[model samples]
Target: MEQTWRWFGEQDPIPLDHVKQTGATGVVTALHHLPAGQVWQPEEIAKRKHVIEEAGLSWSVCESIPTEDSIKRGDANARRAIDTWKDSLANLGRAGVPVVCYNFMPILDWTRTDLMFRLPTTGYALRFDMIDFVAYDVFMLKRNRASQSYDPLLVEKAEQRIAGKSEEQKKLLETNIIAGLPGGASAQTRSSISSLIESFQGIDDETMRGNLFAFLKEIVPVAEEFNVRLAIHPDDPPFPLFGLPRVLSTASDIRRLLAAYESPANGITLCTGSYGSRPDNDLVAITREFAHRVNFAHLRNTTVEPDGSFYEAEHLEGDTDMVTVIELLLREEEEAGRQGRRPRIPMRPDHGHLLAGDIDRQTNPGYSYNGRLKGLAELRGVIRALTRGI
Candidate 1:
């Protein structure tokens, strides 16, 4: 359990020095200024890594190197784009960055209905209210045949939820739902979102998975050559969104993904919060089953309601049993060491709440320092306790 903090680059309000002060030795960051289809210049990679090293932190993982829309579409331009991506990986590997995390969720990285759900304790947290999402999809954004995606009772409930809102609430929901925040990865104007949905009309889950398999076949060899582990993040919410297909959401999906290529370079990000959104995904079991190929981890929890609504719960407080999960990770690491192939997985606290008067101050929802500091502290304690008698 190497502690790493996600840094968004030089523009991030939480600077590199601030991250070092959090007692994390590793920095998880990206070359965000570079556009999606271009190769990350070696000079640029060196510059960011030098900054982190100067702050007395090791550059441990690449939080992302975004896959362009052309790649996802498998358009003619995608071949050149993936070549650029390969060049970028070579640059990062040459600079000694060991892990790269990326996701294939089409058009958007993650989706949430509300960024500031006022919690019962007066703090604010990011929430995914399924009914509100349904309302937006059905009557607000009004995607074609969006009603088919939700159950009849759920659609009726969404209608009720939206009916009571004033005009202001409706506008805010639309803005938060589609317009996105300042530095967040998604950019979707209403028309753009509509166009994006239209683009996915003929692509089903099978086709999307096939595209991803083709992608890994092209990229994993580069990763292998450079000793960089490319870890694909599971779909956030771990399910379909806006009627678009999600290929990386389940344990079986992970099995299939690894089976696509026999290379260890084709691996997973192993996001517990994403997979744990469904009650059936046992976190301990998942770690044991996929531990060898898990190169990165987003350790967090979610509290799911019956209707598919969920909210980010405190790191050690939700449905995921942190104690058991930590123990299992340690056990797996021990087993791997016996085979003389010990791997150190990089993990960070994903999606913390906006607590302690921070919600009104315009921070990235679930990315404020206070909540993540709390989460890291708790997870650190859990790791400490689990490893004490080993």
Candidate 2:
């Protein structure tokens, strides 16, 4: 495993020098300034890569080459997007970046109702409470047929949660949920959000799945030609949000996708935090099953609450079996070595809570330093223990 840290280029509060000091040799980043659907120019890639190299780190993974909305919607612009995506891959290859992480979810990258949910011991952490999310969908965002997304008991809980809110709290929660406060991007206005939610009206789960496959079919070959591995990130909650259908939220989704394309370039960015959100996802088994296809990874853990809420836990203390998962990854690396494959998978401590003195400040949700440094420390110890025993 190649330890990496995500840096948001020049604007990142945590500089590349700080990342290098963390014992990570790779930087996972993207052209955050580029709008979606645009090609990443070669000059931009080279400039970023040069910065990373100058900092004694390699730009190991492009954290994403965002899938265009046209591709997600399967609209007339899909073909153009397929071409543009190929061009981006070529640009990355030209810049010597080999692995790219991306996701195919329709509306949002990831959603959480609470960006600062206080943990029992840790000061505050990112969280997704099912009731809170449903409350936002049913009462706040008011998505169509949002009522149908939850069961009766969940609906009851959601209503209670909504009712419990004060007017100001209600406004804040609505802003937090739909305003995309933590998108690490600008917040969308109420009208824009409404229009965005309305856009998913007819795009059901199956339709989204079809679009994803169409997308893979279109670009996987180009990725293979460029010696780039395109790893699709799993949905953050491993489920739908706001009545939107999430296709890459399960193990079966990855299995079907790999079988569909059967290309070495078609890969998975296996995130323990994302898949571990679902209790049924047996983290170790999924890791072993998809071992051959995972070219990138995000190792973090979460503790799930009964109400479908979950908070970031100490990397090794959450719902994921961190020990077993890492052991499997090491075993997979051994196997890959036997098969003559280089096993340098780029991974980072996915989301770390705000702990220590970070509680008072507003950091990018989940990208805080203190907690993630703690997580990386723990994970490093775990990896060392596993390797020593092995």
Q: Which digits, one per residue and each the tens of the lDDT, describe model 1 over residues 195-228?
A: 8778778888888888889998888988988889
Query: 1-390, model 2: which lDDT tens digit per residue?
Result: 788898888988888888988898889999988887788898888888888899899989998887777788888888999898889988998778989998887667777777878778847888777887788788877767879978989988889989999988877676566533324335676566768767777998889889889888878888877788889999878887777778887888888889889987889998999999888888888998988888898999988877677877889898889989888887788778888875567779988989887777656678888888888888888888888877
Question: Cα deviation in Å at residue 368, candidate 1?
Answer: 0.6
Candidate 2's C-alpha runs over 4 A off are 179-186
Candidate 1 similarity to native, TM-score: 0.96
Clashes (N, CA, C under 3 Å) per candidate: 0, 0
Residue-level lDDT for 137 in candidate 1 = 88
